[model samples]
Target: MEELMRQQQLSNGQKSERQELTCSVLFTNPKFRADKSSTKDEINSIARMVSNAEDLELDRVFRKVSKNDVEETRSLNRSLFEFGHNFEDADGWLKLEQPCKDQLATVLRYMFESHLKTTVQIEINNMYFNCHFIVLQVYSRFFSELDMIPLLVTLPENAVSQKAFMLSYKWMLSDEPVLELAHLVEVYVAATYLRITSLEAHCWKYFDDEECYNEDTACALYVESKDNPAMDVVRNLMLTRIRKFLLTFVATKEFLDLPTSHLIYLLDSDEICVNTEIELFDGWVTIGTRGKRTFGV
Candidate 1:
């Protein structure tokens, strides 16, 4: 019933082709998993991994495309899941599996549709797999597939919002050039975390003596560019909310890999200061905002 309401609200009145394409993405990637892990811990693990971050790497596949495909699609993004999707389970929320699958499909379609690029898809997949695996570890400690309210919020028709968030965050933990992707994940994480998990009593204080980078290092980041634009986006987008999260939960093994108490102290301690005359992450300012957002953080 709730799913139906979401689909109904999505009556954008676009052409039948666009509507069909969006619906088609969902059919293959159904909303619920009949055989979702039964155990509480297993379920949370599934939700956390499945709903970790945005798939920034996946977004890149669509950024550039063949001239012909570009003309045909009208939009550069073969955006499979940007439109609204609704999923709500009042009794007991189920996993938003299809939404994640749909976004993944969108990324795949964009990549393959674009010219034959090198196997960069592997990096995206690796990041996704690792993040899910790690979330599974943490989730296993708690519950199996958490009530997605604690995971990612499903839009009226949006499923990937949660999972894509996980995808984005995974890159933050990754080593740049992969680590560079953290900047993109930064905003998405803050926004999503703020939206979904209003954890008890969060604080935001500037790090007076934080361990930031030197001017030279910042310059090097902007100069260096691997085929990985995902990392580049994250490095480019900077904010305290996202930065602190990555610096705490991601940037360090001492953060996620270590005990939670230890990481809290690490985050709460004095900010690691750094010189930034170069402005590596703070390069170009596109829109009215300081930085843009991707699917992940």
Candidate 2:
């Protein structure tokens, strides 16, 4: 019945000429070629409409409507995706102090990725992050200082035990373009957290070759979940990403036995020299003996 309703709405939506007007400047498809000024005005109008709607759990409630009207659906998607980051200062990350920058790094590496799992894949490709890679570099700088899970300081309160994540939902003014990208960026980062965590939960112990092992025990029931086809596809994709991430740190044997954190520890034992990249990023620290009791301090 829900599918039928969506189809019915789409038919009516096609007949509505008003649906053709659009506010998207990034894509210039046949249906959305409104003039720049007109598009900006329309986006502003929508922003004002939603600015103080203040309905609790608004996105969930809105999803309940299940409209097939394409433009209405899309306009709402764009608005919800752009809500936060509006209040950030003109030079938000650029002008931040070192401590604040450090905090932001923790937020990105751990906090942000854990937040957006609902809408994003666990492993995101370079396609999207390219636009905002600058912020990511900043994230690498400040929070990247630890060899261990900086998770102690970075865990969102909600994530410690609850279903929620700590995310800044600060609403933005109507003008800046990055505001449009903020929520999407949040989604991307949150997905990264889930992907990394999945690796920790499922494959951290085996130091050999996880793929070779997964292949060896291909028929084992514990490795493969239930009989749903869609679920199987998803599981396969996730495993594929996990493999790639592991390859980066995983020596053929090292990857099969331990998780990423343990592996890093194994390689960065006390006698290790300070690599140039580490100094440049200032993301990693060593403690005890050579790395003895040393960190960004």
Candidate 3:
């Protein structure tokens, strides 16, 4: 009984040590990923070597692989390889920012107007944008399946608003980029629905920091975000600002001019930091005195 307990304690200590140790693995080979190279056999050999390593438990070897038929798809395929090691952190990566203005603008313009042999159709609210699959796939994973269907047509009927879609499409091709503050929420909703992550991030950053916050913008965002779940992040940001500065927010012309629904929405929020309910009631009367009876609150 004493021996068994001692063995059990030893095993538990080993597990505790293992849990504290971080593990990471990376594999990079310049020639192995070449088209003519035997990558499959190479990966198998590497897996066996890793599994047999003294420091690596055979059961802990993780096998992850991805392959695409380059001959059929005309796209380079690759796999993920692993070897056991503990790595809490590491830093050796370069950040490159290359801005191509004229080159991209010229190509986009040509692609928009040119009669390309291979093209994909993107339809939004009865408006059609016929574009090169190559260019489209670069910016959107949503169009990556074009390798199989060269002439596929995709519609953003329920996903994107018409105005938002048009605006995003135009902004992508514009030589001088322009996205209005008023259309930020709409564009963000459309971008999120389409899974355009970069555009989604850009729109969110704009709303979170770029634009000046006011009652009208907040109310407009509230109205536009009614049925959309993706807009919740930006909506909450606006609500937080409005709540934190309720007194100053109410003093603005935009607040008094708010529609009934928006006012009610603000009043309904428990998070609003008002001194008393009576203060809000007094403001409501002031709005009423301005003859904006449409403001129900």
| Candidate 1: tens digits of C-alpha lDDT, residues 34-85 | 5762333433444455554234233332343466776222233434345544
- Model 2 stretches astray by more than 4 angstroms: 1-216, 221-223, 233-297
**Alpha-carbon shift of residue 85 in model 1 (angstroms):** 65
lDDT of 3 by residue, 1-297 (tens): 999999999999998877655232234444555666654465465766586543543223433344653322221223333343434333442444566577886765675646355466676767776666665565666666545856646566667777887777666555666678877877887788767777777776667662566454554565566556787667656665566567766776656655555556667778677987578867866776877455332
Worst 10 residues of 3 by lDDT: 70-79
Q: Estimated TM-score per prediction?
A: 0.16, 0.14, 0.46
Best by TM-score: 3
Comparing 1 and 3 on lDDT, the stronger one:
3
Query: Candidate 2: worst 10 consecutive residues by lDDT?
Result: 168-177
Error of 1 at 64 (Å): 78
* Clash count list over all predictions: 48, 22, 0
Error of 3 at 48 (Å): 73
RMSD of 1: 38.9
Error of 2 at 145 (Å): 33
Candidate 2 local lDDT, 1-297, one digit each (tens)? 999999999898976744555543323444444554444454445556675644433444332223664533222345532765554446667766756356675655454444432222211221111112222223333223435432123333211211212221111111221222223223223323433332222232321335633432321321232232323433343333332233242223323433333334434434323344344122223212233333232
Which should have the higher TM-score, number 1 or number 2? 1
